[model samples]
Target: MILGLSKHPSDESIVEGILAGGRKEHEALVALYKKFHVSLERFIIHRSTGRDYAKQPEDIIWEAIEAFVVNVKKGSFTLKDATLETYLKSICKNLWFRYISQEASREERQNKYMAEWDKLEDDVSDMLIEKENWENYINLVNKLGKNCKQILDMRLIEGLSMQEISQKLIANGTFENDQTVRNAKSKCLKKIMELITSNHQ
Candidate 1:
């Protein structure tokens, strides 16, 4: 109806046209967007309201559309028994869930770090109560060369995995593989820990 097809095309036909990779593909995508975009936006807005960590509804909707298109083209979406809208909505839901999970993890890490900071204060007493030692440790970490600092920051502060860090480093020509990143991380951490322990005594 939307695309002016003589009759309603099957989901398979539409998907095939999209995967065909030409002007037909472009028309298919436009047709899909016109058919679903408003409903998808409304659905996302309804679901994300009042959630502080939720992504902007527009962003979520657009990302969902992009994921859906890419996944469909890549054959990841089979569209076996479900309607296209249903499949798209499921993708949006999964994306929202991922966002929520990451937000929760970030908050949890922050709370844990805060509790550890308090304990460090108690353990060190007034001798280092002003957090001078903590500052010094930060300084030592900063002195550990740029790549080491970047690796540690990405892994610890950003909660990225070793493999992700390795890819980033490799892209920047820092090191070739995850093993190199791991070795560098271990060496940097050991150096910092040794510095702290020796200075504490």
Candidate 2:
């Protein structure tokens, strides 16, 4: 029988079943967790810096899902523009920001940085490559917010300038000014960097 974290016996009938947690509903939700929980956990785990925090990514995911269901029940949140999958990803990232301290050890991370650097064959390939270097980076970049992807695509990828990125952000209603776009871009890049380095092996 399935053991550990008790099963939520219902499917993700988010409106009724999840909000109304009887035995039948709860078990179904538990099964949902079993099905996707490990994948969600793996995403978060890849952001940690050590085994200590590696195991905690799932804890964060479960807590976030519970909180999401609660807020939806209370009408404090809605999935107007976001799909269920997108909503879940947001929760995962928010949890990382909220509980980052509990998620990783600094020394373990520093050692990892030393290793990535020590192993780097050349500078050209460190950030770009005809090699295996950019696989992880590309995947991580692919996971960014829509606005981020566009900005990077235009300015960094498509050879547009920061001014053009700002213009695009404004046109897309993501910002009212260039400074806001720049700041947002900086924050997004920082997040990407943090995720990339957090739990490197």
Candidate 3:
């Protein structure tokens, strides 16, 4: 059933297939998956804590390939922006983020999904432990002063651009100017980084 996960093949051929953006493009994408899946899976397996995620690395690879093909088709990206390796790696990273986000969302939506799915308890425990450890660190940050927390929160959590945050804070009268907020932000972040780096659970 699997086709490509065995070799890198010719990069030019793969790139050409991707640039084609049609049925052949899909097939070449599939071929690229078959070529890279095993190696990628092995790479993730070494790092993924023996979870089922390691079992589905190819799915992530395919998602990345599909998204990349769509981007190429839609003119969202050009071949000039990247080589095959850079493009594929960026796709893989984005796919991993999406996969993780979806997985987390699903778990939150169906807390008992695992209980019904027939997985080992120890594996579930491992997931829970990692989740709890991360939450604890977040809780530590929650203990920060409100302004310090808000600065980090806007920039890091809300994913706001620094310029945007500067404008927003000035509008709200949080500081006299944008540079003031930026300076305050740098100090708070450095302090929090030091705190968490030294005291992370």
Candidate 4:
């Protein structure tokens, strides 16, 4: 039989039951979670910064509770210095840090993939337009000068807005402003077209 509890059990008793494991362990952890879940969820929501992450507040709370139970059973939680709530918060905080780091890395990889895809778009444009003479088209595009290459790569291939490209170029001292970026794009497209026509002939 499980130990008796008139109402709220002491934290120490709950911890001991969990450490003992089996039916009593389940009862103790459930009781602990029921007693503190609302507060823990509130804490997670407050800390999540209005961003939906790998888990919702409730999910994080439950996961943390489960981990706490296991750790208590394994003797990893001494529970001598801090309250149970404090330890639970620590676990939740660690989860948030891990989620944020993973999200950042995922975003970085997506940006890199997008950049590469944009470059490929430029490389394959000619092939898409002139299926029969794709080889000649590719050869002609390869012969474009460095300036044309850069202009098209940024404007067409990279999918950057003209204003964005303009700011970047101006910052790099490549051009004076947005108008220059536009003019350069026009010239580059004209040159590429000329190369394609001449190669066709």
Best by lDDT: 4
Q: Rank candidates, lDDT, best first.
A: 4, 1, 3, 2
Q: Model 1 residue 181 lDDT?
A: 71
Between candidates 1 and 3, which one is better according to TM-score?
Answer: 1
Alpha-carbon TM-score of each model against the true structure: 0.51, 0.39, 0.41, 0.59
**lDDT of all predictions:** 0.71, 0.62, 0.64, 0.73
Give lDDT: candidate 2, residue 146: 75
Quantify how close model 2 is to the true structure by its C-alpha RMSD in Å.
19.6
Residue 10 Cα positional deviation in candidate 2, in Å, after optimal superposition: 11
Candidate 2 lDDT over residue span 6-29, tens digit each: 343222344355555676346545
lDDT by residue for model 4 over 1-201, one digit each (tens)?
224775677788789878777888888877788778888888877876796676677777777888887788677887785789899889887876677778889989867855664555454565436556545644665688666677667765577776787788888898887667766766666677666656556
Give RMSD to native, each candidate.
9.5, 19.6, 18.1, 13.1
Give the poorly placed runs of model 3, Cα more than 4 Å off.
1-9, 21-23, 53-55, 112-201
* Global fold similarity of model 4 (TM-score): 0.59
Pick by TM-score: 1 or 2, better one: 1
TM-score of 2: 0.39
| Candidate 1 worst ten-residue window by lDDT | 120-129
Q: Note the clash tally of each candidate.
A: 0, 15, 4, 0
lDDT at residue 164 of model 1 (Cα atoms): 86
The worst-scoring run of ten residues by lDDT in candidate 4 lies at: 119-128
| Model 3 C-alpha lDDT per residue in residues 131-158, reported as the tens digit of each score | 5654654665577777777776676567
Instruction: Give per-residue CA lDDT, model 1, range 39-87, as digits (tens).
Output: 8877766776465654676677678878887988777887785889898
